[model samples]
Target: MADVPTHLALGVEYDGSRFHGWQSQPDHRSVQQTLEDALGRIAAAPVRVAASGRTDAGVHATGQVVSFTSAAERPDDAWLRGGNSLLPAGVAVRWVARVDPSFHARFSATARRYLYVIQEQPQRPALAGNYVTWSRQRLDDEAMHRAAQVLVGEQDFSSFRGAGCQARTPMRCIHQILVRRFESLVVIDVTANAFLLHMVRNIAGVLLDVGAAQRPAEWVGEVLARRDRKAASKTAPAGGLYLVEVHYGDCFQPPPPMAPLPLSGIRDLW
Candidate 1:
């Protein structure tokens, strides 16, 4: 008798420095390809994985989520142990749990949060060289924060989009935008319903210009109003960006309830 398939959601973390990107590509190493390969080895057959979102090359994720189905009945540990055993170094399965059949990892996500980190010290970060951007110049955190405020709420972000982006619409709702300084580090945190390709990097680049006093805070509003890609600053390096979290609806109990805390008071960025 054939067994019913069980749906499972898996939380993943990976160092994106080595892979081409999260999506599968011919003749190239990718996060999806590596994950599928691991799953296939464990199940002794082909396995497909749907991710919460696709990340570009050199973009890392700490809380990336994926979901898959299996006809064989196996405990959650089976997924962790089996998948990790086949996965290469730099990629890991944090946890796996049963999820509703209707749950679509990408579509069901309510919000996505990303953090961009910049080390402003003169010397490069020896340990974090591949994880963060190193900038020797002093940054004006106040100016950057002031510029970020202009991007809050629903807006047409065509100016910040990449030329190769395939999203149907450039409109996206930004729930939060924050810029803070911790000694020599500058952190930019953004939460949104969705994001366009290169959106965060482009926004960070523009904000970096503002922080360096190369561009005024009003330039952000001007760029948004223009809806022209050329009006925005250049896209920043991918190493600085990290997918920190993804939020689902209240019905899912996989992630424990988050206690209410002062939103702007949280200082640890990424």
Candidate 2:
């Protein structure tokens, strides 16, 4: 049999609230299932997809990447048009490009970036409903920024990992942890070599405590030094979290141009 290519990278985005998670479930909706279904339709053959990482239910992504392999070759446009034609409304393929047979999407990524938005207001805005989490209590944004600084650099983030995480190591190199407030919104941006499950949300939760004066700014540093999971606060709501970007090694090229599709009068597949 002829050799089949091993890598086909796709830049994707989705509103994860509607799915069980990224991986396919036997009876529940999932981002992987949706993408695989669309790919299968496009290729006229079954396709299995592997993503950079799984995002929990209700989480969202603006720059999630996935890859798979097939014996068939198709242009980037085919992946865009054919895949999008079969996918449901909330999921989209932003770009598609061919890659080396050995380029694994998950394993090749050097870092991942996440952003969490917090609306610090007495009442949530109707317009921003699905994009941010509303915290009615007043927050000290400066304090939050100070607390976030302690998280930069390498550390064992056992305190911020979710209980369900399966990663073998608790240590990760954090490139940046920035907390900025604009108007009534507080934005937390984190970039790391890798993250444990729910790491970003858990960090956000701990920062929330600092912002609300429930914990001192130094507490963040103390928690990291302790390497204990119980040192952190609750995980933040998934609705406010988004996988905003991913970085790879120098070998990868920029993705192909994306053709704009009309927003209206479009029918979607199940």
Candidate 3:
């Protein structure tokens, strides 16, 4: 008798510096392609993975959720420990569990969170290069936080949308946004129901201008009101961005994912 297919969910984390991005690409390596290959070896057949969100190039992830179905009869832990052994150093399967066939990684997600870490100093980070964004000027995180409040609630984000973004609409609901500092590091944390391509990065760019005193906090509202992309600041660097969490509805008992800490631990800043 044929083994019935088992629906599986995995919490995966990766150092985005190791791949082009999360999605598979024909010419460039990707986190999805690498993970699928390792898991395919364990399933003894081809495997396909769908992630909660498609992170961009150079963006790290600490709580990426993925779903796949396999007919293999290996123990559940095989997907975690066995796959890790076959995978390279930058990525790992953090957890594995059986899931209802109805659950879809992309569709089932209710909210997503991201953190953008900026190292503020005249000197560039040595060990933290490519994992944190570098800024020459010290920023006023308070001003940035105050300005960000305009973004809450369902609103049109056409000012931040990418030209090539294919989302059906320019509207999205931002659940929360916080800009704070830990010593020389300024972090921008955002949680939203969903995002358009480069949306968060554009928001960060505008906040950077506010923090640097180039623009007043009220300018954020003005930019949003304009509904034009050209009115916003340049898109922030992808390296500073990290997909830190994904939220599911009440029925799922999801594990708490770690924060998007920089290579230099946050405590080190103190």
Candidate 4:
């Protein structure tokens, strides 16, 4: 055989409501499986791909990065078009790029970003329930923002980590975190070098308490200082979370994120 491997990267977006998650599982549908099946059909051979990160069930993604090596000899446009055409309605490949052979999706990423959108109305939404989390309690986005400032910089996030997390260390550096309101949506946007399992959702749960006046904003800081998972509020629902971007910092390139809640006038790169 005279086949040569071609390394390629792809930008993907998916609505995770009906999918088990980004990782493949037994007897369950996953974004990775769906992607591999589609790409395999295009390549006329089975293809295994690696993603920037694995998202939990019901969690969405607008800027997921995937990498694979194939000898299919297809152009970038072919991979992109063929993938989208074969994928289910909830998943789509936004772009494809030929990359250096050494490039690996997860290992080469410099940072990752996520967004959690909440619907803070008195009634649960009937239309956007799968996309946004509904909260009947009155929320104070300003207070949540003020408290989130404590999370910036390198710190031990053990208090917010999931019980079953396999990360070797609890220390992670958060580049930025902001909680804000856009119309009916309360958005929590975060960027970090890496994250512990359930870190962002745990942070959101604590802030939700502050927003509801059930706890003072300063309590969030206390929770971090406690360094115990039970010290923080329960983890927020997976439906509200979005894996929005995986940054490479010039080492590689992937498409920019598509905001889950695109309420106009958002000047920031959230």
The list of candidate 2 runs beyond 4 A from truth reads 1-6, 125-127, 253-270
Report the alpha-carbon TM-score of model 4 versus the true structure: 0.96
Q: How well is each residue in 1-270 modelled by candidate 1, as lDDT tens digits? A: 788988889888888888898999999999999998887777767789999889999998877889888776777787898889889998888888888899978988999888888878778778777777778799999999998999999999999999899999999999999998877778888999999999999999999999989999998899889998999998999988888788987846445322111112444543
Error of 4 at 186 (Å): 0.9
lDDT of 4: 0.89
Model 2: how far is 195 from its true place, Å?
Answer: 0.3
How well does candidate 1 match the true structure in TM-score terms? Answer: 0.93
TM-score per candidate: 0.93, 0.90, 0.96, 0.96
Clashes of each: 0, 0, 0, 0
Query: Which pairs of residues collide in candidate 3?
Result: none
- Candidate 1's C-alpha runs over 4 A off are 253-270
Sequence-dependent TM-score of model 2: 0.90
Q: Which ten residues in a row have the lowest lDDT in candidate 1?
A: 256-265
Instruction: State the lDDT of candidate 3 residue by residue for 155-203, as single tens digits.
Output: 9999999889989999999999999888888988899999999999999
RMSD of 1: 3.6
Better of 2 and 4 by lDDT: 4
Q: Show pairs that collide, candidate 4.
A: none
* Model 2 lDDT per residue over 1-270, tens place: 885653689999898777888988899999999999889887878999888888998888877888899776677899988789889988989888788877877898898888888887787668666668788997898999899998898888998889888999998999998887766767787899999988999999999999999999999999888787887888888888888677786967545322112111212200
After superposing candidate 3 on the true structure, give the runs of residues whose Cα lies further than 4 Å from its correct spot.
263-270
